[model samples]
Target: MPVIVLEARDFSSPIFLVRTLEVISGCITFSLVASLEPPKDPSDLHPTFRIFCMFIWCFFFTLTLLIHILSIIQFHSLIPISWKNLTVTTAVLGALMGLSASVVFPWMVIDHQGSLQRPVAAAVASCITFLAYSSETCILRTQAQEQRGYMGSNPGLLKILQLWGGCNMIPLVLGVVQSQWSALGTPSGVLSWQLWVSAVLYSVCVLMSLVTLVVILGDFAGRCFLPFDRFLAGFSLIGVFLYMFATVICFTKILQLKEPGNRASAQMTELIIMETVVASITLLAYTVDLAFSIKLLCDRSHA
Candidate 1:
């Protein structure tokens, strides 16, 4: 049996400080939100936004606490996944999710309701948590370079961005489709093909990015028969084209919609526009990843 040892020095580390802030801020945000009375008119607010924000806070709080405990106990070494990759990945995800929750909870839930104390305070705490997570991500990324972790490399960082973009795109695309399904349907009640295509493309990209990250974390890239660099390069090249097509299709379709005459319509339109912008950014990331992957492959070939 492996003996358990406590790493006392870790408690004083900058990473630990940042993570502690994340946990504290996250706890405050969620508790404030949860303590608020239910909205007087539930329909006046979007419950999904509240639920999403709460989920993000609680999920991150729990996960970060668990990670911290594992670190203190020196239990991470017993796990199969690479600790660096896992921590960096969690930090990156927490930052992105925290940012989304910060923007969304304030705009959709807090603004929809009046400037109540708890909700407003929750939003503030959420923003602070987002900053903490962003700081942690930056710190970890810098350390990753010195540690020579795979995820700290150019391609690895690009993969993380790709994953983030894909995740945002998924929800935005689905929300638009769900809200406008009736308007997007033909006389026969069949939904627009373009809507389906956009959703499918984003989903596929997210799946691929997730699989790539898992492979890296599990240290399985070298054990696979295929050349990982070449595969990444080819996938990125294809992803660039796919995102370009999806972005154009999504933007054109959203443009065809009638101008928003109501709050709900306006919100849906905003989501669609956000999705289009994210797709464009994802396309750019894919292009950059392709370039880096090609360069890496060429260098290996010459060696």
Candidate 2:
């Protein structure tokens, strides 16, 4: 028979407080949104965005609950995954996803609805949940520094930002492409080329970043036969160039669309703007990651 003991430290910790807030706010956000009826207007913001927000909140809530149950039961060692890595990764991804939902839910749904009570409340809860997740992420990151995990280091932390930014860019780019496809009849000419380039850039970056994160979380970086540091450095450099090109093309397309005779709808314009902003931020993260990777490689070589 297995013995179960309650871990008092889990309940008393700062992380527990933050996670509690996360659960509360997550429940509130999804419940409020879910209570509302779907928009019938075809011109209104798509239901997909609403569904995405609800999913983010509900998924994080369930994850936090699982973590709490595991901790209470003193089952950390029974789980095969690295507990610290899992916790930190959850915090980081939760924060990023919460922030996206906070922004998107308010801007796309609440703002368009003209101050409906439930939607407004849901947006507020979403923002609160984002803050909670962000606080948890900071707490974990600070604690992680004293540990031996790769995610505690500067380059590893940058990898999280890169991963989050790539994730953010993918959806925004897809939204823009969807809008363009609807408006332009068929994918053709410069618009088609630009959309294709942006999609490929975002997809490749996301894939590489996700792979790197999985390797780190699995503690397989050292076991890999490849030169991991060099691989990171090389990919970071490539990401910088790819993001730069994609960002330029996106802005140029936006400018062309805004010319005297040509104009996109407000929603499409907003999606493009959001996509460009995410691309620019992702570019900066990659640039910084490249610098850190080089420094890390140099120090390792000297040691």
Candidate 3:
């Protein structure tokens, strides 16, 4: 007998697939980049990191686009089509911002062997971070709230995400200032100083991002308020946060070697160990998150 199809509130399985793609791609890119030899000095910083970020940006952007397309198709057939804060417009804005950070800025802000690509990239990335992150938190908040009382959930988790957004923002803005000042003043000592500051800013923001995840995930597991499914949502965020944290930690340690000629030294070896530890934590986080996202989607569909 042919099974009859029922109207579903969500197109769960595809969302799962898309998210998995993002995670897998992000993980592969991160692992490969982490394995590379750390370079010496700020000049060496520009091209490599920029290219790496750009690749990540493009890959995620594609996934984002595909998800949206699939979403439209699914909504047309199953659930009512709705746009929360994380709408198509929001995704576009986030994508553009990410692209600027990954592709535009490094080219603009950092000089490749003494030539500038374009300085606006860093500034644009900052602006994008503020907007993208703010919108994303808003969407998460709405989702959590909607799921409230259904399976039990806490709205405060969204607040934590928002706070993390603000925290991560601080360094990005500073990074821009540092990049800009160094670009214009063209001071000899200022170059290293500003570059280091920018790195520090990004590093701090990345750390806060991870901490934010830790808080939310803590709530998800123990706080009886979160619906069983939304807990799954928290998992991916935790993983992504940790992955970012680990990668940044490795980069930050390398940035500390400012005097030149000591990038791949014994200190770097220790840093690599640290990076490995962080990566392990992140991957674990990712695994937990994948479980949550999948479970949430499945539950929501069945419910």
Q: For model 1, how does the per-residue alpha-carbon lDDT over 108-150 read when each residue is reduced to its tens digit? A: 7876656588888999999999999999988877773746377
| After superposition, candidate 1 runs with Cα above 4 Å error | 1-9, 36-45, 144-148, 181-191, 258-264
Q: Residue 96 deviation, candidate 3, in Å? A: 15
TM-score of 3: 0.32
Candidate order (TM-score) = 2, 1, 3
What tens-digit string does per-residue lDDT give for candidate 2 at 1-303?
A: 486966676677887889889889899889888888777766445665776777788998999878867766778777766678777777888888898998888777775564499898888898899899889888877763555366656776778888888877766766776677667667569888888888898889999898888777776777777788988888899989998998898789779876886546677898888888888888888999999889989999999
- In model 2, the Cα lDDT at residue 206 comes to 90
Model 3 — which ten-residue stretch has the worst lDDT?
148-157
Which ten contiguous residues of candidate 1 have the minimum total lDDT?
Answer: 182-191
How high is the lDDT of residue 274 in model 2? Answer: 84
Where does candidate 1 clash, by residue pair?
none
Taken over the whole model, the C-alpha lDDT of each candidate is 0.80, 0.80, 0.43
On lDDT, who's better, 1 or 3? 1
- What TM-score fits each model? 0.87, 0.90, 0.32
